[model samples]
Every structure is written in structure tokens, then in C-alpha cells.
Target: MGETTQHFVLLLLCLSGLVHSSAAFVFWTAVVDISYYNNITNDTEENFCECGVYGQNARVETTSGIVVLPRDDPKGCHPDTVYNWTSSPWIALVKRGSCNFSEKIIAAVEQGASGVVVYNADGTGNSTSHMSHPEAAGVVAIMIGNIQGMEIVKLVNNGTDVYMTIDVGSPHGPWITSYWLYFLSLAFFIVTTASIAYFVFISANRLYNLRMHKRSERKLRSEAKKAIGRLQVRNLKRDDEITNSEAHMCAVCIEAYKVGDVVTVLTCDHIFHKACIEPWLLERRTCPMCKCDILKALGVEEESKDSITTTLPQDATVITVAGGDSLFEVPLTEPVRSDPERQQHRYDNRAFEGDTEGRE
Candidate 1:
């Protein structure tokens, strides 16, 4: 399996084990009720109290019988210990210590005892503990406090016919105990921390990608500026065909060229007013007439050779007008200006002059 799947499986197994262990630790209380004849008062007295807890491996059910104590040993430690009671149903009352709880329960079960009640050691008072008697399965066994057990023993020894009933009570463990709140709080904390951490990771990744995209756009715009500087610029004269023809107009500004007009020739052989097209090229990096990428055409940016073909006709030629003379020739294949400061100055002057004339 993959590493993530393995970790999930391991976590599930651990949780399952924890639940099983917690269940094992859980124990049920026993509602112990006793009735006897009060000889001095000449009346029957009964007492009911939830003062006992069932053993881990004992049967959690109701059982009633006369309370009987072992004749030889109160702890029921000896395997041969016997009971003197001749009743049809009886529950053995044993003391703590001297032997394991399983042994005491087993001794009582072998002697026809319907149930077993084990009391805690001395000085423990009314506080009882959950008992474990794995070896004595299927027997109804519970543990009562020393004080309660001693009271029942005294009544039985005084020749009073004391009848006891043990009933299953409520279950108690980590889920219902004081630890429950702490466990729930810990789980909530873990879930909240994981959610916050995942959200932060996603947000950081998106921010990083956005920053990278903006940086790339700025770099491409810078490259487009460099490519625009290398394009050819010419000053139009009155004798030029473009200045005389009404059909020829700059795409940007949508006006026919005039005498002394400065224009930039694009790689696609389409020309536009230098002032209008420079800003357009810097922002869009493409010819307005044919939508051709100037950066790719001028080799300033990398693109496939097959995709760089311009839309201009095969017979197209560059036009240059100087001193009222028009000359048709192949477009400039070399860089127009090599020095950065000279190129920037020339481009700025030509754009300023063109703008000034357009306004008038």
C-alpha cells in the first residue's frame, strides 16, 4: 500500500485498540439489597444501596440468595473451603487479600454459591474497586466496601436470616468520567490545527503563483520595449505615395500620413504613427493591423519558427522617404540603433515631434 494509506490504517488500528482497552476498563455497579427480621423491633427491615461494582469477567445479571460465609477461612483462599449453609440458593461472602479474586470466586462457584461478594481490605471504608476474575467466568461476582461487607457479616453471624439481591447497575468508565471533557477538548484541538495548517498551505501556494505570474508579465513588457527600439522609423515627405494616397492611413489614429510625419514600420510590413504604436507595442507586444507578436518576430522572445510567419504579402517592400524622394527596398534586417542612450533619445524626440504635429 502507499505510505498515506499505511499511516491511515495504522491510525485506525490504534484507535480501535484504544477503544477496546477503554471498554475493558469499564465496569458496572451492582445494586445490592438486603432484608432481614429485626428481632428487637419485631419487624422486618430492608436496605437497598448501589454500593458494589461487578468484576470484569463476571456475569452482569440479577441473583438473590441467603448470604453465606466460608466456615474455615473468611477470604475463601483454600480450595477445599466449605460453607455450612443448607439453603437451596446462597451467595458466598469473602474477604479481600490472602488470594486473588479469581480464586475466591472459583472456590465459591464450586460450592454451589449463586453469587460471590468480595470486600476490600481493611481501612478502605466504603470505597470499592472494580475487580477482575478472568479465570472465574460465568459467575455473578461483585466487590463491596469493607464497611458494608462487615455489616452484612455481623447480621448473618447473629443468626438473622439475611437475604441479599444483586442487580446490574449503570456502567462507568472514561467516557462518562471526568476524563471525558479532556479527551473531547484534545480531539477538537487536533482537528482545528490541521484545518488551519491546510488552509495556510493553500493560501501560500496561490500567493506564490500569482506573484510569479505578475513578475513574468513585467519581464515580457521590458523585452517588448527593447524589440520596439530596434524597429525602423522613417520621416514622411510630401512626395511619398502614403502621404498623397487617401487609401493609405495609419491604423492607429486612423488618419492619412502628412508631410514630415514620423512612423514606425512593424515586422509585418504594417506601419503606424510612431507615438501611437510605441505605447501600444510596449503594452500589447503585437501589431494592431495583423495581430502579429513583434517580440517573437524580432527574436526578442522565444517562439516556434513555424508560428512566427507574418501576414504581409510576399511582394511587400519597405518604403523610405527622405528630402521628397521615395525609395522602395527590402526591410532593415539589422538592428537600427545599437547604443541604448542614443536609441532612447531618438525615439523620444520623434514621438514628441509626431505628437506635436498631430495636435495642430
Candidate 2:
């Protein structure tokens, strides 16, 4: 797959994992309803509230039983704690402290309790948190506020029987109740849009560059054809110097010239068979022997003079005197005269003199 496709697939996998983890954090709220006989009014009184959260591993179902507190250790943290109630359907009420929620829930489950209610710690007026009790599964477990638990504990202590019903309420998760969900969604949208835009830009730039390169190549080939037509062509005769000698040969075909053969001469004065050199010049646009560009030589194409400068070796140019005697050498660009009394300047001064006369 392409790199973009791989990145999109990876992004989808991360989104799927995030959704699954968010679902795991989701938990159900509990609706706790308690009813008891009020001795002052001689009537049955009922109080209900959806202020409870179920444990992570607990069964999310309805269960009703008589509320029962531990006779010893109200937190129900002890392994040997017992309940005085002798009933088949009894809910254990324990304070939140001293141990994990699993220990308290397991203690009640072992004692024939159908459900467990754990209250929040002291000073936490009516706030309850979701409990995690993986070791105590299958049983209905919920956590209520501290003030609510104290009211039921006081009723049971006053010899009043309290019947409690626990029912599953609404589900709550981080995505539903947290502000970070909006921030994450916005960030993901911005990243996805920027990636798509960048990919499109890169593809368009590559296509544009390729088209420009091909257009330039076709234009250069057309100009080379024009330059070839302007070169010198000749028909060899029997008495020609090339046909009479065996030393000269066509560079393209590597064959000696014969009488009545047609040939073309390039700007560098290198001659080759017309048929052989035409195709070679069309492709390379340069002489095979001297590497001379026909387009620049015939004025078919203009090139920068500064960019076409010749480079020479570090050694100076050697000069030969009239009698074949050696004399001082001088650099080509900057010539220096060794003797001020010389008869005439040995180096050619026509180029410099012409520039001076033109200015005058």
C-alpha cells in the first residue's frame, strides 16, 4: 500500500482503540429506594434517589432486600465479620475505608447477601464514585453517599427494618461528561485536513516539474535541427585530398572517404558522412571530434558569455622566438613584457587595440 493509505489505516486503528477504551470507562448509575415504618406517624415512609454508582465488575440488574449492617467493623473489612440477620435476601451496608471495594463486596457475598451497598468516606456529603471490584463479580454492588448511608445505619440501629431496592440507572462515560472529548475531536479533524492538503500539493508539484522538463527537451531538439541545416556539406571528387589519402576517416562511421561520397563539415572543421553525422547531431547537438556545440556556433541559441569561459592549466603559455629559440612565457589573460626595450610586443595586441579604437 501507499504511504498515505498506511497512515490512514493506522489512524483508523487508533480511533477504534480510543472508542473501545472509552466504552470500558463507561459505568451505570444505580437508583436506590428505601422504605421503612415510621413509628412517630405509624405509617410506612419511602425515600428514593438516583445517587449511586455501580461497581465496574458488578452485575447491572435489579435487586431488593432488607438492609443489613455488619455487627462488628462497620466497614466490613475483616475476613471474619458476621451479620445478625438470618434472611435469604439481605443487602450489606458497609462504610468506605480500610480496604478495597473488592474486599467489602466479597465479605457480604460470602455471608448470603444478595447485594452490597458501600458508602463514601467521611466529609464527602453526598458524592459517590464508581467502585471497581473485579474479584466480587455476579453480585449487585453499588456505592452511595456518606449522609445517605448514615441515615439507613441510624434506622437499623433504632430497631427499624429498612427495605432497599437497587435498580440500574443511566450510563456515564468520559466522552459524555468530560470536556477533553471536544478538544480531541477538534485536533484530529485539523490533522486529517492538513495531511490531505499536503499530499495533494506534493502530487501537483511533481506533475508540473515533469511537464516543464519535457517541454524544454522538445524545444532544444527543434533548435538542433535548424543548426544542422546551416552546417557546410560537400560532394567528394576523385582528386580530393581526403579521397587520395588513407589517414582521414569519418568519425561517425569510422570509414575512409571515397570518391562521389557526400559529407558534412561541422564548425570545428571535423568532417563525417552526411547520413551518419545528421542523426548523431540531431541527438547530441555537438561535434563528435571536438565537443563543439553547433547551436552556439551557428547562432541558433544564445548562451551566457561569462558561463562559457575557458579554463587553462596553472603553467604559463610558452613562446618560441623567430630563430626557434625559447623565450619567456606569459599568462594568456594577463600578459607581462619582460623587457621594456623590446622591438615589438610579441603577444597579439589587436583585440585590445580594436576595443580602444572603438571607444575613441
Candidate 3:
């Protein structure tokens, strides 16, 4: 589950990078202005002019008079033609042709025209195009809808003067520079910073847990060493020295303790081979039979870096009951002497009241 969450975070970061670095472009638009007086209406009204920059240098303030060289000839070019431009600036209106856009613009340049407007072919309606005439520089050029061009043409044929204006329109560019780009940058920064912080948090948490585990192990080992040192380790005595009944079989290894065999006595008074219980104490820190912490039984506990001592009453009594033996109490008035290196201990107040005289 942790690994899945981590992968999800990584995937989000990748997506953010892709979105932040993506590219965007803007298209050019033409602004055409046209106006003429209508004899029937007896009023001069401006015509709706929607133009697109078709070629280079399309920045004419105004152009008037007739539109000439209007059709593409056999060579797919609108050849030069003379126009009576002494009254007003000449605006050349041409049709879409098979020849390159530059060829048509060059033809108009030869005819002394001030600007050029290229309308669409017969089948295409008012669809405008962006035409770049790099070959004919400083010559204002633009494209208009076929329907619009035809309207102006009819007006001109009627012998009415039509005036028009042209210039470069609004600009467009990369998406990153747009308004929404700011929002994207903000979100990207927030998510990226959060991811970095989360990564650092995870690293610090893991390190802390590791250090705590190592400290716990060291603490347990320290207690184990103390308990092992205090414990009695010696060779098993002969039958005459120590009674055979006290040398019971080890519950851990399930083996009897033979004379001369090396062994250790636990705080519970239970005995086992020294080798067997040391590893068990280090791992489990408990007696095999009673399942009690030997460290606790030995009165040696690791509370913290500093030792905590608890005082108990000095005068006490030990009571015990054995099978086939009567119950009795033994008084204990001795204040245990504290060893310099070991923690103060309270001697156990339990003793076995066995029938010592009935043994023989």
C-alpha cells in the first residue's frame, strides 16, 4: 500500500512537468475597414470589414479606386495591369490561383498598386486565408471573403468609388504566457514543494525508527549482561554434595544435568545449561518454564538512562507449602547489602518448608 501511494505521487509529478513544459502558439487575424455611399439610400454607411493578414506589409491606411487583374491566367499568375490611380490609392483585388502567393503579389507590384486583396476561388465561400508574400516587401496585402469581394466588385462596376483600410490585427503566442499559465505555475509550485517535503518527512521518520530499534536492542543487551553476570554458573555437583532431587531436568533443552556439567541458575531458582539460556535471555529475556523476565526477577530493570530505585520494608516473612509437608513461615529481617555496580535488590520472600527429617 505504501509503495502504491508513492508511485501515485510520482505519476502526479510527471504529469505536472508535462503540463508545465507544454508549448502553445497564437494565430494572426486581419482587420479590414470598408465604407462607401449608396445612391439609393442617400446615406454613407461603413461596410462590415473582417479581414486576415494574407501576405507581408499589410498595413495600408486606405486604398481607393478599381480592383484590377482579378483572375488567374494560364500561367496561374495575375499579370500586371494599368489602373487610373491619379485620384486615389489603388487597391488590387485578385482571385485565388494555382500559382504561388508570391507570384501573384509580384505581378501586382509591377502594376503600381498600393494594396492587394485576394478573394477565394469559385467554390469556396467567404473563407479567408493567411498569405505571406516575402518576395513583395513594403506592399500592403490581405485576403477577404469571396462574397465580400464580389459585393465590392459589383459596387465598383456600378462606377461608385469604394474606400477600404487594412492593418495588422491582435497578436497570439505560447500558452504559458496566457492568463491560465499563472494558475498552472502556482499549482505546479505547490505540488512540487509538497512532494519534496513529503519525501523528506518519510526519510526522517525511517531514520528515527531505525535509531529507536537499535537503542532498544542495546538496552535489552545491557540488562541481559547484568542478569547473566549475577546468575550462578558452575559445574553440577555430585550426589553427596547436592541432593539429586534438586538437579531436575532442564525444561528448555529437556536434558538432565549430569554431575560436572556446566549450568546456570535462574532467578526463579530453576536451572539450565549456561549456553542454552543465555541466547534465550538475549532474545526472549524470560525463564523457559515460568515465562517470567529474568531481569525483573533479578531486580535489575532499564527504565531510562538513569536508574530508578524503589525502597521496600526491611522486616518481612517467607511462607511456603510443599507436597506432603505442613505450611510454615520464616522471618526475614536482613537489609540486603547493595553492590556498588548492581542495582539495589529485594531478596525473594518465598521458601520451601519441606519435611527434612522424613527423607531418611
Candidate 4:
């Protein structure tokens, strides 16, 4: 039993990890404003695909913040070197390196950056790696592909003042569905083989037990039959009230209990139809007249004292809230019921607060 439980726990952990990891690996895109360093006065700023360009140079601004670089060198900071970001509160533009994208973001954050915009450090074209900063609290980070990064790097190399507004969306990575399938297959194989082996071991142990103590086995079987018979008798006695409750009528709706309809058989064995008691419980979990284990029937151990009131019966048309557990009651009059379509339209327009209240 303990070994079986351990295997179940292992299966659950693997399944949970697979789900979270797969969700994290979905494709994500980042949108940001790119300013070229060469064309400072022209301000030919535009949105570019982060994955499309290399060596991208970009700046981020808060309502009030300053750009600080490592070495306290305010000017001529090389965006390509990851070492340059250890200085101050400036946007650290780093080139893509062999390190994971997360590692680059951490390096920049360590230097006290308000945000980090990682562009392609390489010459040109698109590139992506799983680069994210683990401790990036209140700091934004973006990874643009090589091509776009390079254009920004050029603008910076030309001494252009680059600034950007970045909007980061979802994470991008490999599909983990196959890994999930693999995990499930492995779990199935383990469980199947374990079950077969366990069955064989149990059969062998039982055979040994029977051979060693045949008389004891006969006595045990006889005692087990007597215990089971006693349990059946006790259960039969307890079921007498339920059998006798067939004639009870719901006090609230004044309707006779229907056969095959589920009933909230009370502790007192006073059976009430489920539909009749459902609204009553929603308003109050206690039995309508005799307050008893109504909530227990609903599987609720604790309940608030507040009882929700059911809408007073309307002629018959009711609007149901989508996905909501409660049923709404709307009265339908004869004139409105004559044309079902018109009645429904009126109900929709009224409930939705649309124009054409009475003008329909």
C-alpha cells in the first residue's frame, strides 16, 4: 500500500510540472518603440520585431528616472558587453551571448537598471534564447532578435539618442506536449508492470498462508460471513424510514414527491423532492420547517446564515444567468405568451437595458 501511494505521488508531481512547464514555453512577442542613434534629429522611430534584428539599442523611461551605466561612464557605454551593465540606473543594452536570456537580464539588473532591453549583439538578423531575469522586480526586460538589435546598435554607434516604449507579452518557448505524453506513457508503463508484479506477489503470499494454516483459513472465512451478515441486518434496519417516506409531500411547493426524482432525505427521514428543496437551501441550507442536515446533503460542512431569496414566480418565462448555478424566475403573462418570439425579445431587451423597451 505504501509503495502504491508513493507511485501515485510521483505521477502527480510529474503531471503538475509538465503542465506548468508547457504553459511557460508558449510563443510570446514583445512590442517596443525603436529610436535610431544616427538619426537623432529625424526621430525616425518605429515599431520593430524584436526577433527580426540584431544588436538593438533601446532606452526605457519612467515618469521620473535617469540613465546610469556601469563604470559611471555616462557616455560611450558599449551595449554589447554584458559587463558594462553593472554601473547604474540606465537601460542596459546587452548583446546576445551564449548565456541564457535570463542570465543576461540578471547581469543587467545587478547593475541597478530601471529596465533592460537586450538586442542582438551580433551583426544582424533574428535570434532568440530563453533569456529572462529572475530578480527583475519593477524592472522591464525585452529580447529583440539580431536584425533589430543591430539597427539600434548602429544608431547608438553613430551617437544617436535611442529611447523606446516596450510592451512585453507572453513567454515564448518549445512545445512541451510531447514531454507530457512521454511522462504519461512512462507512468502507465510503471503502473501496469507494478500491478502485474504486485498481483503475482499477493497470490504467492496467499498460497503460502493457505498451505501453512488450512484450518485457520476455514475459521476466518466462516467468521467473515457472520460479520457481513450482521452488517447487512443493521443496514436493513436503518433503511426502514427511507422506505416508509414514499408518501411525504414537499411543504414549500405543495407537490407530491415523484418516483426516481432525487430527494433530500432528512435526518428525520422526511423526504422532500430535490427541486423543491434546492431553492429553499439556496436561500437557507436548513430544512424549510425542521432545520436539520440540509447542507450535509449538499456536502457543505459550514454555511453562512444568509439565505438568498428566490424570485417570485412570474407567469413562466425566466432568464438564466450563463454558467451561474441559480435559476431566475420571470413571469410570463398570457398576452406576451401568445407570441413567444415577441415575449422573448421583450425579455431580452428589458434585461439587457437595450433601447426599444416598449417600442418593439
Candidate 5:
């Protein structure tokens, strides 16, 4: 039975060691990262400080034990009583008296002790009091039993050699925890990289699309301008052609008037193709040139008040005249021979001469 118990205890000790080793690995390997001003910059690096190790200036606490040291000397106290309740680096022995644990510790701090170990002066059970450097200075304090206090006090009084030890808990740092943290940090890095890549791609795509749209709009505007210019050029050409046709010849669809056609003269003397002017006069009763009122020109005194109608020609005649083609014919539509001894008088006198001869 004794051997079995020893084996079980050894196994428990081994398990405890493994657990501590694992904890140490995890703490030492864990990566700490800091990110500041994320919008402006992303700078990250590994932290090198071991998480499981304590620094020399670290704050710590002591187990249950009364401390004894010089209380009034500033040189012996690590931190002066002004800043911390007690001076550090020496055990303090405080007797339980008229004050509570808080008061006792305050007195001990005022006396410049490194650590405070308060003990009950009258009672048997000494409630362990944990001391804190409420001032944020690193002073370790603990409480101990009356017997422990008396032992330390006896050494202080007798001037005998005494040594004190403090046990502080250490962090566990192991390899597995280090690797785990390292991988986690790596994963975070990959994710961050992918996110940045995606953002860049989307921005580039948007910029490209914007450029393309602008280019397309520019092209469309250019084409429209060209079309408008062409249309204006075509209109100008058409106007020039119409002016030339009116100057050199009549309109292509209508010929000029022949000699026999009835003619209405305009005040401006700008004659048009008769077929064209006839339709125009029927619609507007005015000469095509100078906008002269044709009815007034033909002797209507008040052209606007009168309903003028066209009359048949009086003494109108047709005289055959030569034109371009072989004996191409033309006619005079008005009485060109208006003299009394002309053809009309000759025809009238012949009949009279014949009547005179018959009477003789």
C-alpha cells in the first residue's frame, strides 16, 4: 500500500510539471500585436518579451508570514514610506494592538518597511491579511501566526542571524503554446493580406469602369457634333444650288414663257417661269418681285376694298414669229401694230372703197 501511494504521488507530480511546462510554453510563445491608426497605416510586428518571466521591478505578493526589518531608516527601505506604506526588500513584524488590519498596515508603511507581516497580539487564530501597495508601488506584504511573529521578533531582539525567503508565482512558458500563438498570428496576417488585395482589386475595377464610361460619352458627343456639322454643310450646299439655278436658268421642272403666252409684267422686271408665277398669283394676287399688288397695278383704285377679277384680253392678237427649231413658232399676244395706217386701217378702208365704186 505504501509503494502504491508513492507511485500515485509521483504520477501527480509529473502531471503537475507537465501542466506547468505547457502553460509556460503557451505564455512565452504567445504573440502580442498592436494596431494604431488603422485607416492610415498597418504596421505589425512580434513582441519579444517573455510573458512567463517577471521583471526586476515587478509588483508581487508574499505568502502568509510576519516580516521583521528596520522600520525607521530610509536607507534600508527600498521605497520610502512617503510613497508606499512600507519600504520593500525587508519583512515587517507588526503586532496586533488597538488598530484593525488596515490601520496596522498603514502604520507599518509609515515606518518604511519592505513587507508587512501582521500578527495577533492576543488571539490564537491569525487571519491572514494580504497587503497591497495601494499607492501602486511594488511592496509585498503578508500576515503570519503569532508563533511565526515571535520567532522573527526573537531573532531581531537577540541580534541573531536570520534569513527570509519569499515565494512568488511564475508564469508557465512552453513550446506548444508558442507555436500555437505563432500560427494564430500568421492566420491573422493572411486574412489581412487577402482583405487588402480584395479592396485594391475592387478600387481598380471601379476606376477602370469610370474611365470607360467617360470615354464612351466623349465618343458619343464627338459623333453627334460631326453629324450636326455635316447637316449644316449639306444645307449650305443646297442653298447655293438653288441661288445658282435661279440666276442662270429657270427651275428644272418649269420652262420659261414663250412669246404667245399671256404675260403679266412685274415692277422689278424679274420674270419667272410663267407656269410657276401663275400658281403663285392665284394664291397671293401679288407680283412675285417687289410684292407689288397686281390688281392696283392694273387700275384698281382701292385694291383692298375691291374684289378684283381677271378680265379677258381686249384687242388681243397673235402674230407668228420665228424661234430656234426649223420654223419653230412664236406668237405676240397683244396689239403691237397700233398705228392708224397699219393693217387694221387697211382692212377697214378696202370695204369703203368697194362701196364707193358700186355707188358710181
Candidate 6:
């Protein structure tokens, strides 16, 4: 989870950086000059910083005097705002608002205005923003603060001609526009949030499965204990054995049963030393010789079908417990009965009944 969060933060930062670099504003410098008192007032002059240039307006050069548009044009586009190719190049000055920036720039374009200057709305300070006028390609456009635009507007309205100059200025900031900043912030936030959410969901699922697996193991162990309890147990005796003809070994340890040797017998009539088979049955609940689940055979409720990972014969020593494919088959034989009625069951015990039936 920590690693995931770190990666998300890095990705978000990269996105923010991309938006900041790609969406930048170009700064423009406007030199305003006004002839006052017939050049006797030293000709008032001021330099103003301009911002918010359209992409098409970047790096544009304008070397003409300025012209202010009529205040009450029907299209908010004064006839004077348009430039004539035959005349000297001119820059048109206009107030902001009453329509979109694109519309205003388009109106100026029809009149041949080589460049456009839009001032801020009434009483708004000189703060400026970038202009996106897709239709105003090939035209230079810049915005000046309201205070500066109004000062220039007053001089032009009073019939005082103001000479203007527009030029590319110094580069600025890592964050060029507010809209880009907002957009990047929003995108970063969304991606990071989603990544975190997914991480949490996966973690929760794994924990849930782990708990369920442990619970299942416990239930399997409990059922096996009950099944093992129902199996038959006996002690072999030397005196009860018939004259030595052949020897039989315990299937589990490959050792011969002796007097006082305790052993267990499964329902399938397979026998194994008690200590050996008891542990195995308590875990698996299946006969080692035939792979039959004693629990299910006895009609006990089960969680599911047998889920052992390995396939092996049940209730027999033929199956290797060490995770190998090798099998060792035990020899089948007939039982020697000292008595008739129960003699049949004695044969399956792999030896004559010994130790007087039940001394242990």
C-alpha cells in the first residue's frame, strides 16, 4: 500500500508539471506615448506590462500608432477597429466584455487591425489573463490592466494621439495559467484517489480469503479426529500366532507386529501400527490404502468434495507420503481363524487375534 501511494503521488506531480509547461502565458510590453500641450508638456510617456497573448499573437511585431475603437459600436466592433491594408499598420484598442474574446478579435481582424489590445472591465485592476481566440489566427493580441487601459483610453478619447509599441518580453513562472493549474489539480486528485481505492480493495480481499482458508483447515482437522476415533484397535500376541510360515509387516512403518504391539484397522480391513496411522488419519480422515474418505463413508457432513492436492490410493501403504509418484503394493492374504464366527474378521487383522482380545 505504501508503494502504491508513492507511485500515485509521483504520477500526479508529473501531470501537474506537464500542464504547467504546456499551457503558458506570453508576456508583452506596451510603450505608450502621448503628445501633450503640442510637445510642450514633455510628451507624457509610460511603459505598461501586458499579459494574456493568444497563441497566434506570440512573437508578433507591430510598428504603428494606436487607435481606440468607438464606444458604442453595434457589434461591439467599431469600424475604426478594422485596419485597411493600403494604410499604415495600426493597433486597435478596445475595452473588455459585452462578448467573447474570440468575437472581438474576429471583428478587429475584418478591419485589418494588425494587432489588438483589450483592457480589463470597469474598476478591475490591471491583472490580466491569457486569451484563447481560435478564430484570431495571424493577429497579435494582448491584454493590459484596467488602470493602464483606462489611462490610455482617456488620452485617445480627448483627441490626444497615443503612440504604441508591442513586443515580446521576458519569460515567466512554472504556473502560467489558472485554468491549467485547476485542471491538473483535478486530474491528479482523481487518479490518486482511484489508485488508493483499488489498493485498499485488493488488500481487503486477500485478508478475507486468508481467514477463510484457516477456518477451513481447522474444520478439516476436527472432522478427521472424530473419524479416527471410530477405527478398530488391537494388540498383537506371539502365542496366538500359527507356526511360522510367512511374516506380515505393519503397512505404515514396514515393521513386523510383535506381542503387545498396538495397531489400528480401517473399515477397508487394512491395518497399520496405531501411532503411525492415527496421526495420518487425524489429518486426512481418508484411508491410506484406498483414498476413501472415512468421514463421508460414515455419512458425516462435509464442507466439500475431497480437496487433496495429490492423487493416491487410499487405505494402503502403496502410496508414498513424500510427494512422489512411486507406489509400493502390499501383498494380499487369507486369514487363519482359531475360531469360526469371528474368524473372518481376524483374517483382515493381518494376524491371529492376540493378547486375549482386549488387555490394553
**Model 4: per-residue lDDT, tens digit, 303-332?**
222222234333444333221233333322
lDDT, candidate 1, at 95: 96
Give me the overall lDDT of model 5: 0.39
Question: Per-residue lDDT tens digits of candidate 5, residues 149-178?
Answer: 565556565654344544443223334333
lDDT of each: 0.76, 0.75, 0.59, 0.45, 0.39, 0.58
**Candidate 4 positional error at 226, Å:** 63
**True-structure lDDT of candidate 1:** 0.76
lDDT of candidate 6 over 57-120, digit per residue (tens): 4334444555555445522454354332345466677778877767777777666666777877
Better of 1 and 6 by TM-score: 1
lDDT of 3: 0.59
Point out where model 4 deviates above 4 Å: 1-18, 36-44, 50-89, 98-103, 121-124, 132-139, 170-360
lDDT by residue (40-66, candidate 1, tens digit) is: 999999999998999989998899999
**RMSD in angstroms, all models?**
16.4, 14.9, 19.2, 28.1, 32.3, 15.3
Give the total clashing residue pairs for model 5: 17
Top lDDT model: 1
TM-score per candidate, chains pooled = 0.45, 0.45, 0.39, 0.32, 0.26, 0.40
Query: C-alpha displacement of 208 in model 4, angstroms?
Result: 68
In candidate 3, stretches whose alpha carbon ends up further than 4 angstroms from where it belongs are 1-177, 238-249, 254-256, 304-360
In candidate 5, what residue range of length 10 has the lowest lDDT sum? 27-36
Candidate 6 off by > 4 Å? 1-180, 239-247, 304-360
Query: In terms of TM-score, which candidate is stronger, 2 or 4?
Result: 2
Write down the TM-score for model 3.
0.39
Ranked candidates, highest lDDT first? 1, 2, 3, 6, 4, 5
- Residue 165 of model 1 has an lDDT of 98
Look at candidate 2 and tell me the lDDT of residue 132: 84
